[model samples]
Target: MIRLGLRLTLSGGREAAARLAVIAAAVALGVGLLLSTLAALNAVTTQNNRNAWLNTGAVTAEQEHAPSTADPLWWLLRADNFDGHLIGRIDLAATGPHAPIPPGIPRLPGPGEFYASPALGALLRTVPADQLADRYPGHQVGTIGDSALPGPDSLVIVIGRTPAQLSGDPEARHVTSIMTASPADCSGSNCRVGTNSNGMDLILSVVAAALIFPVLILIATATRLAATRREQRFAAMRLIGATPRQVSAVSAVESSVAAVIGVAFGFGLFYLVRPLLAQVDFTNTPFFLSDLSLNATDVLLIALGVPVGAAVSARLALRRVQISPLGVTRRVTPRPPRAYRVIPLVAGLLELAYFIGRRPADSGGQIRAFLPGIFLVLGGIVFAGPWLTMIGGRLMARRTHRPARLVAGRRLSDDPKAGFRAVSGLVLALCITSAAVGVINALTAEQGVPQGSASLSSTVIGDYRHYDDHGNQLDSAASPPEALLSALRATAGVQGLTVIHADPHPAPSDHLAGGLATCAQLATLPTAFGHCPAGAQTASVGPSFSVVGLDRLLSWPAVWPSAPATAAQLQNLPVDQIVVATDGSKSAIEQARTLLATAYPDQEQPFTIAEDRSQMSQRLSGYQQLADVVIAVSFPVAGCSLAVSVAGGLRDRKRPFSLLRLTGVQLGVLRRVVMLESAVPLLVVAAVAIGTGFLTAQLFLQAQFGYSLRAPGAEYYLIIGGGLVAALAVIGSTLPLLTRITGPEVARNE
Candidate 1:
């Protein structure tokens, strides 16, 4: 039977060959996308393994008290007990001639020989060898290999000295030990390596898994469309005494052939694109082509899964047609989609309601609860799509008097499931685009625009420079000198001398008038507060703002002028200041900042400028990049699905369209009919999908982030409008095929 199927397919001539080729091409594209995605995942996994090997330390313990000997430190550094690899370190000294070595060194060095990690070695080389001994109080002998360190980027140095030689300052302390993985722990080739802890692997894995379903759907839809023309042939075979099972076998054979060809082509495609995929740096480091390759198991999965999946989909599509001795009966009119399809949607809404009613206090917890709700809502929308499409078709039929509309509407009403499936990819793309735009808008809505020339082009002062890696300012850090402040005040361009002092006490009341110098200054700023008393100190007080009344105050870093600053409430917090130039010129402001910086020769905290506009642009740019990625992945899938549907519809209607052409139907009318069939449903579905997405995003934003809903911007509308236009374009592209199928030659053939 399989041989017979193959023979028939080959001999079926040009049309059959063309159909097979189209099906194979579509399948290959889908398979290639999936394979590339998997390959990228493998690359990430490989990079993770490399990182794990480099980061040898697995566990760490901290001790407040210093140990008597360096033996415990060596144990911590080189310990290989069953309780995972251990490493820990404590400060050895502040500034002295004799100091204990830092962590990450493989072994204690002799008095004249000290070892450093590559990063530390680089730093040591920058300083003169004689100065290194005086400044670092250690003999910099050599650098340690990566194997002895936790990560290649680490900066560390080790010194060999007795406890008596170490500094006795209260802040001076030595690490008892900093351990690494024992050899046995990393012994076997099959041992699992550690992963990069950025959580991107899990996220990418989840996204890839989600994408698999849609890719498979596209593949199945493509194959089903390709086989629509072959249904009558299958029915005729059944009439000639072929069993239903035999008919299925024939389908399986045809599908398996196409799928095998496609999978092979897909592998070649993946190989071609592997280099491009290697350029994507999700972890800030580009992965090698070898890292992003398909292993043996991945190859086997594609080799077997694609063909089997295609064959199974073919069998399922053919199940709706009855095969008997007389002939096979194709069900032109499908049953109405069930209303019960909405149960999931309703249940999801109820779950959201339940969650909202509980009113979870923690915003993070609310977001976690909302994630499951999001999935449920998506499933509901997908399952309910056919029913919605049916209703839309009926409404369209009633509203229009044109023959094209009537015909297209009836067709959709009859097989809404097909119509729904055809537009499913498009609808999903639109929804996701709308949701992303809406959420981004809502999050950024509260940000105020910077006022006047107060842009980052000017110089400002803050405590940013004095802070160490741990965010604590160095003890020797001092306020900007009185001379620099006076010089800046006397500078020609200097304008707003706003000193944002750390308020030791702010009135706890939530009245704007009390925080402001007077109601007059408060009136100059945009405030949500209403009704103020005529006094410098009103009964109402919440947050304090500088009395300077600068409109460009929002440009300052980490400064929320209207909102209560928790940082300001801390006792003895350092004061920060912003110097805006009168001319509001970037060069002038920059010149002022330079002069201020020069005042403090050993400047720990340098002057800065708050360039709000550029910062906002950068933030929006990032959001746009994210949106572009989503659109790139989704739009093509949807467009292809629409194209496939049009092709399939034309195939199914070939005879009817030919008869219409023979009966004096104008070519333009026929074209209109085709356009209406694709265009009307798309317009209706896109509107519904976009609306749903926006509302879903609004609800999530309100519940999860407590952000006020903001209207989507012009770009959001443009994306949705573009999707509709693209759908129409895809439909139009199929018209040439319609002309070939609906010719008078087709009518005369039968």
Candidate 2:
């Protein structure tokens, strides 16, 4: 019977063939996206694990504090938090040759030589080797890959020296140490650290999993839309003595065939796109081809699972449709969706409230608790979609006097589930985009972050690097260079120039090393800097004061200037170490910074301005770009799915529409009905989704940071409104199909 059903479906003439082809193509595209994303995720994870293994052993141990120097295998780590990222400087002799050396480096750094990460190498390349050779003591040879570190732009420098040689100060605190141990010796609880590099990969995989939900929803919607006409044919089978069970089985088989075909095509598409996925560089460096590979088991799982999922969804969609001969022929209005349909939404809201109400043990606990709430809320929105659609339909019907409005309203009321299904993908897209825009606005608003008086300048000049000019000396005791100081005071546009000097000192316990900042040169500073000590003594830079402290002291970090620098000017200024902060008029300070930078005859630009509003905006710009990419990809897919739904509806309603045309209903009214059928529900669902997203963001921000929400600007509304218009355009594209279905010949054919 299944074979007969398959043959009937496959050979059911041009219309069935075309419909099946469309369904298959949509499914294939959806599955392809899922598989490709997963493949890319796996590739990145593999590379990260390999890099971590090379960085530390398979079963490495890490202690919060460095272990005693009696053990030669433990590498002492000193983390210098620069900017927002961590730069790890590890003692290579203590770590030995634990990291796997790729073909690039012939051997590990022997004695004075050091290996830097690719990111670190990029930073080092900007500084002259002669300047670096003194402190580093050897040639800067090669770069390490991500296997050594997780962050994309993290700068890790592995110095070739024993811990004892690196530092003799016993009072100095240690941040963490990577232990070199055999896998056998570091089993289970004995291992101080979990060594498999799956944390990032797992997070990405979960996100990928979440991402597929909408794709599945889209596929199901497309299948259901395309099946509208097929349902009538199945009913005829029932009339010819086919049992309902038989009819369902045949439909399932037909769908399964299409699904299998789609899955096959999906695999091909994934394979074809592997190289493109490999090119994706989330880590700044593109992943190797080997990193992006999917295992045989994964490939098999995708091959089997997607088709099975598609077939099951098809069966479920068919459950509500009556297959009886009489029922198929007669006009039967579907019962209004039950009020219980809102139960999940209410439960999800309750869950969100509870999550928000509870005071978590820590930030981590709050985040963990909050994730489930997010899922629940999103699930609730989906669950409540049909109910919301039905209400919109009932309201529209209640208020409308026009025939077109009456038709659209009644159709929506009779089949709210279908209406919701048609635009489910749009709802998800709206929620994501709305939430992203709202959060981004709150974060990037000019008033979002409190600005200090220090930042209130038309122009500012600064230096970021503190590299030693001579060689391997710590240079912790050196004061600001007299030449640079004299030059800064001598430069044009020199307002009240504040020289914020950084002094590195050993902290007793909290950190491996610390810096002290004195607001000695400035008469006034930002309020956040507090008061400089009574004397010239230095205040230790702690968590509140670290690099973030510079922002408050009227002295920003070593920001490299954006204006072009000449070779002669660059050669004259100190590249790595110099003075920061000279404020004046825009042109004056810039010229002053240029003159100060070029004052030294043989130094690289003495200092570059590192801390400025431009830097903050640049960070926000990255976030904006990421958000735009996500929306750009998702919105089009959603729009296409909507187009499919509208097109399928036209195909399904051919006879009814034709009858309306024959009964003197205006063609324009019928077109309006079609438009409202899709547009009204879409607009309604998008509004609900967007509102939910905004409220969700508000609650989350308030709970996490005690921050009050800010209203998003007009631009955010414009973006969302643009998406709605695109959806409407998709509906408009199907008008020709409506025109064909409502023609006189359509009625005669039916």
Candidate 3:
């Protein structure tokens, strides 16, 4: 039976050859996409593993307070921003000669030396000493290797500090050994090395789900191409006294041949495109090419799974022929899809709506509540597609007046499930695209600057007060030394400067509003202080004295306070805040920030309004980039499935179309009929999928983020419009094949 199947598949004339070719091509495309997804996931895992050691396990308070030993190393990590980029700085101090060292470096550095990643070294060389290089407090002795860095573009530095310098810092930890994995209890700047945050993991889950579904559809659709013809042939073998098992074997052999061929070509395709895949920045940094590759196990699975799955799909599709050969020979039409097919979809929508209305408080709870709804919605689209297509077909048959429309409508009405099957992949793709685009739109739109907040883009604010872990005041400079103020004024971009004095005996209830400044001095920052209260002198200011409080104030919806104060009392106050207005240039801002860092090393870093907004935009862009890549990959796969289905449909109905052509029907009319048969069901389902996607997005946003729905951007429109046009183009390409397959030669009785 297997031999017979092989010979028939190989030399069963042009129709058989065409069928094999279409199935092979479709399977090949599906295989390639699946492999690419696997490669990308592997890259992410590889990145986390390589950088995990830096997260170094935290020591307990008891261990930290114990007697000093050379075996354990003391480490403190801080994040510093230069321009809009994040630079990781690790401060290390050794208590003895045997202190443990982290991966990818030689001996621990002495107090005056440091090590920098290659990217950071290049940056230090390019940027001025005052702006960036001087902030490190040491000379570079060596370059950190790739094993220690997450990506080629990562900026990291390891600075050597004395034991006394890190003594009282509560954030410091003593580590006897490096961690090989991310610690479960790790949080904040120290946890930046290996693990992804909860929000990032959610986005990745969404991307994976969106991509995998369409590829699965493509594979299933591929195995069923030319299914009608295969059924008749298999039924004939069943009628010839061949056992059912033998018939199944014959079918499997035929399907597996094409599948094995496709798997080989798919492997080739993945290797060819691996370099380009490496360029995609999933985590805001491009991965190394070596890291973006599949391992031995992944390769083995792909090799075995594709062919076996194809064979099984083919065998299952012939179940009707095996049970009763006469059913297929007599041309039986299957039962119409029932309304129950829509139950999952309706249930899913209701579930989502309920969850949205409830609005769970914690992130974990929200995710748990939303997962079932999300899964139901996805499953429902697939379940309800055929029923929706059937209803559309009945409406088309009832309403059309033209001859081509009449014929197309009746055919669709008869096999509405088949009509819907052709575009199922496309329906899923649009749903994912619409939902992703909608969420992205809301996130980006809501990131605009807060209202009533001052536009102090050119100003850098720094406070010179230091606090311990217990929030106890450690050191508070009454004023910046006169020499330091003179040096800052001479900086190239320094356009204006002012000082804010802290009230010596601030009331307990008004501690946050203790900073005092005269009207003339406050007027220099008209954009921020906003025309300083009319005729007021020495007004008390709000939390603009500290960088942390100022950042919060700018983003929150509150007015910047400027209540009048007595000059006599203000004069006795000490200087607490230094605000520098720069010339609104990047160079000037960096220069001013560098001066502040040099003056107050222990305080929180200074920042401008522009940097704050830029950081938010960068974070949002990462989400957008991920969605864009998924959409880009999905559309092409959907288009391929559409093309294969169109070709397969034409091959299956060749005899009927040929007879129609011979009975005085023009080829152009038949073309119109074929076009309607595919287009009507496709357009109808696409609309439903898109609407469902947008609704799901709205509910999800409201439930999880408390955000209102925002209109999608131009990119959303382009994706939808271009995808439909491309799908139509795929349908049109298969039209020429119609004239060839449905010619007068095809009208003869077998």
Candidate 4:
């Protein structure tokens, strides 16, 4: 019996090779990604943490006497395992009148670093663009306090000068070093800093919640194994005295072999792809290279557990096969109680209904409110698959003409669950394709009219010394200053002019507002703030602005004069002076005061700042780039999962495919049948997923993000068509196995 069993299994190996080959391939790929992800995580954690001490940099103070709700300094000083720790005191004028000098590591600049993109290094808090111009005309620059945090990204300043620039300042006494921090360091650290394509860290967390996808994946895998593996083969072995456990063991052995090989290959590819990803300079991220890694545990689990899991799953399914191999012919399929299959869907719907009616009261604090949409979509897909299959099968059955069509239609009808399998891949693929298309569209779009202004003409201000609008330098020791403005205005299409100026602040990043200002005419100063009156105070310019009343522009909301800031609020007081921003209102208020103060009463200011139109959709595009990082991993993994499903199915039917030629069916028809077989099932799954994903996007993205998605063109077809094609290709790759499986039947039985 053992010899016969071995012979049977061996003869069939060529046919079953398709299943083993594909599953092996998938396992290898999946394992590879798992390894690379682990490796990358470890590399980042190890290298950047800088001996743990650097990773945990913070301020510690000695509050010997304190209350439970006391100052943060006291807690810092009261370390349970107290050893010498690095603490850099941040003395801001807002926190104290004469802030004491700090006493710790002095933060210094690294070498050969000229300009770190705002995306890289420590996040410098953006000093509002309007505040870059000299406020009191010559107030020496300094920082005071922090305002509300925008989100996960902490704001820091990227000064133009090196750390050496301020080496001698009294303010530098306690000033320590600056290093990049992970989002977890602060409540809002997870914002643009460490997040991916799925919004920010919060949304990424939601996407990571996708860890659950694999549990179901394992189940589906087990189900497919049972479906393809015949009942009588296992039963006959048992009848010949092999124990049921032995059969289970064999199944597990098979699964393990395939998983190990698949994983090894998958990880290799993941690392290979890392270099490509590294080339992309993600916005708002510092540029640096870090080594990648693969965790030992993740590899071990996939290698060891997948086979065991397959065995356990197969045993549960095969126990019934052992009960009665005599049921052979009918064993190709058996009826189940309607409730057995129906109950799962009913249960899902009930759960879905309950969830919708009573969303968890603690659904959110800041960004979590929108995660439900993803769940709603995934659940909807799971529940809707069978229905979609039934509908799609019905439609296919009507149109099918050849024997292949007949076979395809019959297969779909015989097992509705197969439809679910097909839909899963299709839906996932379509979602990814649509999302990719959207991303491509967004990245290529224009930056738009300009930020924070209504001026019509383009303006640049950092290089104020030379070039004119026509790209020619003034070519003189003295630039006409307004000559470029005259040239542009002289052109026919020029409606308005804009201006950008360098930040007069002392820090190197002072140039980074990169001092963009806009106006209708070059002579028109960025107004009130950037310009200094001839007779104004001769203070060296730091960060100061001339106050403008919000009452002046009924349009611009960002800085309206009604907000009421007086001269007293100024760190240094100028009699009859008020602090303001580079914004238009401040410009107007400054102009009025300066004209009254230094007396330039007759200047031309035109159509106001409020007239500019901005495309708010671009912001979503920015956020999407971040979201991609968070959710990008899922797409390829899902594709691999579908690949295995298709490959496995083809392997299971190799013998049957070979046997079909004996019935005189054309090889072409049989091949078509196989393709249809895979396609029919998948279309349903995609349909189900599409419905679910759409609703989920609506509920989550629209409601939470204030982003609206519409079919800008034939997006629906593109989504559906793309999904089906990918599903077909992955499953279709198994076609060559058909010829191999069918070609060798004569030798086996003879």
Candidate 5:
């Protein structure tokens, strides 16, 4: 029986070969996409693991303060911002001869030497020394190994400093050894930094969830192509004394052979496109090529599972043939789907509503609570699709006057499940796209700065004070030296300068009055800090004020009120803040920042309003890019599924269509019939899916952040429009085939 099946599948003429080819193509697409998603996830994990050790500290405050001579190294990690990019700086000091080395470098460097990642090294060569290189203060000894960096574009510097140089820094740790575990695996104060991949992981999970269903649908649809013809052939064999089990084995063998070929081609397709996939920056940094790979176990599972699943689906499709061969041979229509098929969808919606009412306080909590509802909703769409199609078909049959409408509606009502299956992939893709677009547009909206403050775009504010997490002042450096101040004033883009003096003994209630400046000097400050009070000689400065909160303070600048003060008092106070107004050009702003950083390399770098906005938008942009990529990939996959299913439908109904043509029906009428058969169920279910998606997005946002519905961006409309057009185009492509198949020469009975 197995040998017979193989021969039939391989050499059963052109029609059989076409069926095998279509099935193989659909399965190949599904497997390729599945493996690609899995590889991307693996890359995220690998990157997180590689960069984990840099953020993990092994010493306590006590050990850091009074380190024993036996301690191997002193480690201090600091973050530096250049333009809008973040650079990680690790300052190391060797305290003992037998210091434990980090993963990237061969040995610890002495003073005046540092190791830079390949990306950072290249950056240093391109950017001027005054802007970035001056901060590192060392010659590049070598490049850090890939093992120490998260991705190829990561900027990292490992500098060697003397023990005395690091002793003054309170945050520095006296390290005995480095911990290799990621932040999620580490506990307590030892994990100095939080994981950066949480958002990426969540987005990827959403994408994976959105994609997997369509892939499965495509595979199932592929297996069922030409299913009616196969059942008839099997029914004849059954009537000729073949056992049901033997018939089942033959069906399984045919489907499994196509699937096995598809699996091999899928692996080839993944390898072919991997380099392009590696270039997508899901977290604002492209992944290393080697990171995006499946392990042996994953490979083995996919290789075995796909073919077996295909075989099973093929076997299940022949149940009618097995039970009573005469039923299939006589072209019996199966029982219609029931109203209860819609229950799961309603239940899922109710579950989502229930959770939304509870309103979780944190995002993590909301995600955990919404997962079940999301799964239920997705599953419900699949369950309710056939029922919805049946209802729509019956309504069309009742109302339509056209012959095409009557024929299409009757066919749909008889096998609504098959009609729905042809376009199910598209319905699901639109649903996921709608939800993602809604959330992304809302979250990525810009929080613009106040009006009339555009002049502050090139103004730089430098502060020399450090504060703890609670906003309490830890310590403040003395005013900038006269030479540094002179050099800054002479900088190419510096247009104006103002010095803010610190009040030595501010009253207990006057926490914001850390600095004082003359009214004329304050007037020269950024417009964001409202015009100095009229007729006031001196006024107090706000707490470590910078461009960071300029947007929030626009409406209430008077919170730091001005007061009367003597010129002697202003002169007596120490300087704490330096404001430099530039030429309003990007280069000018960067030049001023470089000078300040050179003066106080250890303190936070000076910042501009533009840079602050850029930094915030940069993070949001990454999410937008990821959403776009996922949507872009999904549309073609769904289109392919729709195309294959439409072609298969034409092939199965060729005899009926040819007979209609012979009976004097026009080609135009037949085209409309085919179009309506696919489009009616598609348009109806698609509308429902889209509404559900937006509703899901709104509920999720409300539970997580108390947010209401916001309009999605232009891209949302484009995706939805493009998806519809693509579906129509795929359907149209099969129309010509309909005309060819229904010719008088091919209209004879099988």
Candidate 6:
């Protein structure tokens, strides 16, 4: 009896299986994405662990203070409110005539703790440009800085009870000082820099996972109906003698099998993408990571849960094996009260609420815009979808002059439910396509980021080489490259010329070696002009971009003409250092940086070149983020809707075609009506989808996400054309199916 029941149920499940296949594919897509996300998280955690173990001595209770006022090192070591040992002291002082900023000194070390300083960057510490900057920990030399802390004049101190006690200092340039941690706290990059590279991506991964479920549910909502349609043969067995329970069990089995297959496919996709994911290297950035964390838990969860969930979801989705009293009253009519009509009302209230509740507290502009746009879409779908179906049906009926055309029109009206489904699917497809195109356009647009109102166009700082008066090239090996500047200033077409050399932190190197890049806190006086004032004194900045170029006593920038150069960045530079390009052009920038370190062991330096955005357009042209799977699913669902529409148009002729073949009408005429009907709705739907898609695209991607929506100008129009062509193709594909004139099958064929 069970076997008989199983056969009966399986026979009735073709329709459900067909519908559920699409859902299964969508499920597979979700699983693939989930796998990738899990891998990324695992990579992050693994690297975090390795890093913690590698740099274990970074945490301490010393407060690791950077003397706020008047060299606090002296005050810190005074033994007034002390407990453990006093890690030495750090200070800066003018060591020569051209000493960077002859400010108060800040370097000292009571060796007992740990005196750690790097001799690498000391070469660039122009006593005249900066002192203590070369002394701080983890400071970048040439990156973003205001050239603070006189290098030659400033120094860092490291004093403690033991060598291990002064193992690592806060990246106060030069890693100036290190001291013991009473209790070791092996922390990750949160304590240092570069520990967490893809924090934002981690959040995005979770969101991506959440979005997957909704799309799957919507697409698969009708799967059961499909199964029932296809399994008529099996259902007949149940009518004869099979039990209902056995029938349901067979359904469960089929659903379970499909779900498992889908999950397996998803995992295959995940592993396929792993190699590509592993190739990314984000090391230079302070927040970079060469290795992403990968965890098995996430992958395993999806592998196991998705299959079970799919099976359960299928089981629950099918409400009953027993035919309802109403089911027995079964009507061939597919019409259901148009649930899509509420779309408009829901959308309206959402819009009304959007405008009323918005506030600055929510980061206005984009968020406010997102509100109304979303509501409008939902409303449009609900209201417009049903309306389009009714109207399309009515129009077909109204326009059909002949008996054949007339019959097709009324049939379409009678089947508005199916019509609505197809049109809605088309509209949805259009929305996604437009949104994706818009984002791609925004990302690949050739335009550099503007700095305030300044435009950075194609300006060149041509091959940089310097020459002397006698046409003899100056030696770039020994001293600061001053000769090159004089010659460049003399050259024509040189709209602006400003030479940047390395600025050093006066701090020691070891403490600086452990990550957190900026630690230089230079004291400055204001200038009259908006810029820094150049004088006997120097200016400095931390590794980060915040500007601190003035002391309280200096005149404001409005009153001064220039920003001061520290002694380190000016006319003076340490002698004897013939900076070599060690690593060569293969890594010209990195090689230059490394050479600087080898030559001057005790200062901070930057990457070889600063960012220049003269050709912004040229830089952003190659990225293509095409989500093909999504497009494939959407386009076909839309085509099926088109086929139903065409079929509706030929309903009266379904019998006529049967009669014509019996009497004498041509097959071609039947084919033509199918074509005409399909064309009409396709065009109508294409127009609606295109128009709505554009508006939705502009609203979400640009207005909401702050992406550019500039008329891809002509490109956008071309997109409209593409949409039309796509609609045509869908209609065309279904012509064969639509004209399947089965010689008047049962009387309902009409």
Candidate 5 backbone collisions, by pair: none
Cα lDDT tens digits for candidate 6, 43-107: 54443333321122243334345332232121122100001111123322212223222112132
Better-scoring candidate (TM-score), 4 or 6: 4
For residues 504-607, could you state the per-residue lDDT of candidate 1 as single tens digits? 34444423322212233233222322223443222222222322223333322222233233322321343333333334543445445445434432232223
Summed over model 5, clashes come to 0
- On lDDT, the candidate that comes out on top is 5
Q: Give the per-residue Cα lDDT of candidate 5 at 407.
A: 91
Q: What TM-score would every model get versus the actual structure? A: 0.67, 0.74, 0.88, 0.59, 0.91, 0.49
State the lDDT of candidate 3 residue by residue for 165-271, as single tens digits. Answer: 77656567767766655422344544555554555455557666888788888988988888888888888888888788988998999999888888998888888
What TM-score does model 5 achieve against the real structure?
A: 0.91
Candidate lDDT (C-alpha), each = 0.57, 0.59, 0.78, 0.41, 0.78, 0.39
Stretch of 10 with least lDDT, candidate 1: 78-87
Over 4 Å off, model 1:
40-202, 205-213, 277-298, 322-332, 357-372, 446-476, 480-625
Best by TM-score: 5
Model 2, 1-750: lDDT tens digits are 798878877998887798788878877887787676667666555544444322342223453344544333434344322232335555544334443233234555655778887777775676443223233446666676555554455567765655465454321222233333322233443322222322342245335534655776766765565665666777677777888778778877888788788888888888788777666654344666656777887788877776677667767765545444566556466667787876776665566567555658654476466666677667777888888898898899999899988889988988997787778788887887776676667766532334444433332434333334353333222233656567656655454444333323334564412333434433233333344444433333322121343333344332211213222332333222333343533334444444443343212222223334434454455446556645655677687678778888888888888998899988899889989988878988888899987877667666654555578889877878898988888888889888767888978977
Winner on TM-score (1 vs 3): 3
Kindly list the per-residue Cα lDDT of model 5 for residues 337-379, writing each as its tens digit. Answer: 9999878877767777777568676545666677777877888
**Candidate 3, poorest ten consecutive residues by summed lDDT:** 549-558
| Tens-digit lDDT track of model 4 for 293-326 | 4467766765666556655665555656666655
Q: Where does model 5 exceed 4 Å of error?
A: 58-70, 187-204, 357-367, 445-463, 493-518, 547-554, 558-560, 565-586, 608-626
Query: RMSD of model 2, in Å?
Result: 8.8
lDDT of 5 at 87: 80
User: Which ranking of candidates, highest TM-score first?
Assistant: 5, 3, 2, 1, 4, 6
